[model samples]
Target: MADKEATVYIIDLGHSMGEKHSGRKESNLDFSMRYVWDKISTTVAASRKTWTIGVIGLRTDETNNTLDENGLEGYENISVLQEIGPMSMSALRELRSEIKVSKTKQGDAISAIVLASSMIEDFTKKLKYNRKIILVTDGKGAMDADSLDEVTEKLNDVGIELIVIGVDFDDPDYGFKEEDKPKLKKKNEEILSRLVSQCKKGVYGTMAQAVEELSVPRIKPVRPFKSYDGPLTLGDPETYPNAMSIAVERYFKTKLAHPPSASTVVVNNAPSRSQVDDGDEAIEDNGNGLGAVRQVRAYKVNDPDAPGGKRDVDFDSLERGYEYGRTVVPISDMDESITNLQTKKSFTILGFIPFSSYEPHLSMGEAGVIVAQKFNEKAELALSSLVNALYELQSYAVARYVNKDNQKPFLHLLIPDPKLESEADCLFDVPLPFAEDIRSYQFPPLDKVVTVEGTVLRTHRLLPTPDLSKAMSDLVDAMDLSKFGKDDDGNPTEYAPIDETYNPTIHRINQAIRHRAVHPEEPLQPPAEILLRFSKPPDELVDQVKKQIDILIKKADVKKVPPKVKGKRKRETVKPISGLDVDALLGQAKRTKIDPENAIPEFKQTLGAATEVKAIEEATKQMGDIVCTLIRESFADINYDRAAAHLGVMREELIALEEPDLYNNFLRDLKKKIYQKELDGDRMDMWRGKIIAGGLGLITDQELEVSSITEAEAKKFEK
Candidate 1:
């Protein structure tokens, strides 16, 4: 089950928010919106039905919230931008239009908070949810301080997490302070900050902190899913009196995440005359009139008695088959049951092994957590004792686990994790790989070279010199991230923390998706600066290891490779790296004759040695004649292979020389002669087998556009 959340984002749109501060180009409202947009975009990307969001516009021109509609006082200039519901791209587009600088600044921030709390309470009613309220403002507007205590109590009573983010606010912990002397703004900031501090669960920070932290990817909070919740046993209770049974629950510790995939869409054709009167669209447009395409699959099998030598079968008629080597092995229901391992859901302690005996590489799957079953005090005490004993003895428990009935069992390595602060003790478990699953692939030794004569030599080019090896080691040490950053108290810390590093692929894709949804006509923006910030080493670190890098480069004798030319055939042919004009030199000879016995090699030499157009035409014409002669004079099917070999050589040479017309034009004329029985007496079998089967037909545009074969002509010639 997915978790339910109702979060309301209150953004101040007062007239003062339109002014720039601290020489920044963007307005204060836009600066504050950076945090708001990111939070909303994340929820939209999740696409979870239960993750609902609401938006409120503070200090707006008009009053339109639940309070203002009910004729409540002090709710003026505050409007509900959106209701609590699952967010979508359409909702984001609507919100973008609504969040702009307002003409008035009469609304009170505390009053807006009260109305937001009322909205969540009324919508959620008595249902349990992860309720939250986020407010981003510049603290430039007036805020009523009366009933502040009561509002805090109401937020805590309903379990709403209040996060207040002020623009240009002071926070000693964050080391930020706005250099100003406005008493009214200072008072508003203090009031909002106090409201957050008084709440039961919340965070109070500056907008700068929130915006700066947005680069780090947000980890989605998932509802704990119990894989199993039953008594874990050692030995059967009926078989041994000393058998053990403890109520334990297993939950996934980590799960894989994937970005949303796009469905294919097709254009909608015009409707018929009868359906033209209706205004209904064929399907939903993706910003264009293109609608999602429907997929139709037909299963068929070869049937000599059926039409077209094939018959279609319903999907239900298909049977599942398992692949055994190269063949599919199908089994009946009874046989499948016999083949499957019939085991009940169980987690049993198979045995214990020393922690040193376990290898981390042996863990194959995602880790799972096992804790004592809820409300079972005795089970908790027993599991805690087991965890303590395992920790003290430096041992791990190997358990046989079957997550469900009739499922295959797997071995799990259970490592104890004990907390000294009186937290519940639990075991971290990883499924172990079977011996058959491990692959022992062999690779040639990198430190030494073994000659084909079975002699080993260590001082070869494959082996790195001692100087190069030491230089590489020194470079690695110089670029170490450990102790690269200063902590809050000015202590050394890791530069790229694990919690801060994000998956660039996931976030970059999501950013592009959201951008396209909002602005279909515009090109996608570049990747966010934060996503690419950690891709390279720190510049200072690179500068420090300049000497080491230079030494390593010299030792390895590395040289820059030339850039590859794109679309060589689209323009003109690229020159060879040897800088020699082989074609021009070869064309100077103007060779014509090609030996029929040595047709392939001799034909290649004629093409490679030719430096003129007439020489190429002569050689190609002679080769075409040789191919037809081989097929025409063959004793039945004896010379078919020889003819096919000659055709293959002609095709390869034309493609290399970017002269597709030379091969395609000749092949087409040859195909016509064979099909029309002009080459030999009824040699269609050779045409079908060697010409069609070997794919030695015409050269399409895929080979090169220099060919004379039209799209229709290419298809007709293939048949």
Candidate 2:
């Protein structure tokens, strides 16, 4: 069922609105009217058949067009342009024609509020709709506080929300003189603030903030995650009894109330510097001639007159024991008992169907509408799982409430992303708005279904379902991963590449459904196949290269020689005793200790150096081979960032070994291999920049002088 709502726009047409407001292209009246129209349009589109919009101009020069609603008459400046009605293109066009700047005096703001509230109340009297009155005005109008209070009481009694968007002042961007702001009536300003506050159902802000807010669809608070344990059956129970006892979870289309916080504050703990003089009093001198002396109090524990004087005790005779002071009591104690709150209901998954088959049902009945996935994590997972599962079983559960008020049914799409199921306690999480809350969610009639190779399609809407299953299979098969990113503990970590735009599974099903509904007349076409193309490197790949180059340049900038290890010195020998005084020196012999620090082990430099050098060369050779393989594989499915990062580490190691020639040669060869691959001009430029940046230190005057040697000559005239 559609969410019913009524929004009545009360636009100010006072002569003051004709004045220019900063940051707006049109006059204040014109801008406010347009903003109101946009808000109405957005509300209508989002709410569909359930929303209605009305327009009421605050001040109108034409006395004949004045409104006489709710028994009040002679409101010469007020005009009822359009009454509340369902939104349509014609209605919006009519509203645009009616809104204009008033050439007469301003209308009574209190009267305008009373009239708008009455109109909204009348329109939403029979229907269960949310009543709202959006007032757009400048603060220079006149109103009595008593009248405002009366209207506020009426609006509150009718449960009508009043949102006041005042074009109170010129925007900072507009170069308006200080004198241009009109002197607003103090009583009118106070009344407007009081009216909005007393109602306690609306918000107040500038037109700019209000206009920005209307651009996006308003959403409710996030429903909590839920899970169920039961058997899920699919198809007709009498004919085909296909069922599974799978642990199921439901996710709602919702988002967190607040954004992930990245705000931080840094504290400066350095002591402040101040001048002090050697005296009992401190002298404070200003730039002026006069100086003031401030008395400084000092305390000495050793003085007998001091509050905490030194204690007298016999230290030698006292027993060694610790002193205990008074025990401190806490202000509050926490209840440590664990409370287990059951926030989910157990429901059986009744049936399952292919997402392609489910697409048409999303746009079919007036009673059932599409429910969009809220968070990106759930959306991305659902699309991926559905597309991939289409290759195998190609079915998702359709759940019904075991204990609910309405007991209505809705499609239950499963998003079996591995990250969601990594938790040990549960299979996955489900979100709320369960069967009790949902009403009239009916699937499309099965008899009218048309199947193209067993995949269901609605006969009324002739559309082709894309072969997502085939595409997903090919994508999985194309992955030839040599390695994955790992943490310091050597555990492989999840790597979500930045270039997710190319992935066909990102919100695939939902986007398709929305597109179909928006253009119901047009036949659905298959989405373009996501072929593994490598003509141009993705933006992320280029960014990765630049980041790697930056790191390498920084490393080369802070290059330092390894600290030298000093060998131990030779040990000195003890003088030999002339005579073996057997009995006398036997005890001294036992007490004598060896000088372990001075006893140095024999050092062999040449052999150790050769062995270390050989090991370095072998490791470098292996890494070089891996780098070359990855460079070639980059044309396929290999991650360019990982390859570049490995190459950067290899370059650093080679530089540490003082193998400048080898490092330069490796870069030159790597460049050739990259160029040989299917790289476009942009990719070629990125590679060139990376090479120049990373190999800046490795360049020598000799290499520069011999740079004239062409690639052909170097290969052909090899010695």
Across residues 47-66, which tens digit of lDDT does each residue of candidate 1 receive? 78899999999999988987
Clashes by residue pair, model 2: 226-430, 250-430, 250-431
Mark the regions of model 2 whose C-alpha exceeds 4 Å error after superposition.
23-25, 44-47, 63-74, 169-181, 185-187, 212-719
- The window of 10 residues in a row where model 2 has the poorest summed lDDT is 598-607
Q: Which candidate's TM-score is highest? A: 1
Model 1 error, position 52 (Å): 3.1
Residue range 1-719, candidate 2, lDDT tens digits: 55677887888887878987576677888667546755665554443777888787887775423246345564657887787777754455566667777786657777777777877887788667888988888777766466666787898888888887777433344332234455564445556767888896966666776655443223332334432223233334446555333323333333323322322222222222233453776554432222345666553336576556764445443333333566543222122112223233334455456646644333222121111233445444443444346335745445544423334333344423333433211112133344455468677563456456767645433322233334434444434222233556987643333342233343233334434433446675455333223334445545545644444445335466765322211222233577555535666432122122221110111112223555545455555565555555555434455556656765554444445455567656666655675432224533544434444324343443323445454443221
Instruction: Score candidate 2 by lDDT.
Output: 0.52
